[model samples]
Target: MANDFEVGVDVGVDPDAAWRLAGDPVAIRDWFGPVSDIAVDGDLRTVTMGNGAQLLERLVDRDDAARTYSYVVESGIPGLTSHRATIRVVEAPGGSRVLWRQTATSDVEGYDIEARLSGVMTAGLESLRDRLEGAAA
Candidate 1:
């Protein structure tokens, strides 16, 4: 079984702007991490971060009308197995809401590493929300 966790952020941007920003892979990288010069070809995106952490991933599924996109990280920090995330954009009371749902389990480490990854996920999601809201503001 996979562990499931979800986080959401509401931005003042409308659904159309949110959808456009969220669905665009380059824009995603821009908001998500220490990403630099990111590029996407179809479902695949390659990003290089300043810290030298590289991300290579593939888009698993996307529903444009639904404003959702799913992806699997192919290789990022060994010993993590099947790291998958789903991001959805929705119409919220204030403007638009972005939700991130992630599923993953450690392949080689114990509880401490799991907790650490959870923190990383949380921080990243929060940063993403900040970036989106800042841009839309």
Candidate 2:
């Protein structure tokens, strides 16, 4: 079965700033708390999570004009056959909104992959909002 999820958060920043922060690979650790280390080469990123898990991600597409980025997971995470995700930033009434979408296929038994991923995305987005808005304040 395939699991998909989309999560978003609004921050007190413009679309450009939000996009710039979110799109930077090195800046990921500042918001995504789980990422302990990030090594970027060209369009590929190797992320080491806090729990010692490592993941290889390939950048699939990036549209600066649209403030969107997409990537696919090449490895890591048990039972996951495939994973693709995208993050997009758009203008909102007070500031900007970032939306993260994930689609995955997992064959692991006794694990709620969707819920876990959803929680991670939610926390990450909220952390991003706090970091950007707090710095401005």
* Native-structure RMSD, model 1: 2.9
lDDT per residue as tens, model 1, 1-137: 33677777777878878888777767766666656667788878887877888888898788899999888888865777778888888899978887778777666645234355556556665776677678766
Question: lDDT of model 1 at residue 116?
Answer: 51
* TM-score of each model, paired residue for residue: 0.79, 0.92
Residue pairs with clashing backbones, model 2: none
Clash pairs of candidate 1?
Answer: none
lDDT of 1 at 27: 78
The Cα RMSD in angstroms, rounded to one decimal, for candidate 2 relative to the true structure is: 1.6
Model 1 spans with C-alpha error above 4 angstroms = 111-114, 117-137
Q: Per-residue CA lDDT of candidate 2, range 1-137, in tens?
A: 32787899999999998998987767888899899999999989999999999999998888899998898999987788889999999999899999999888777775555678788879999999998998789
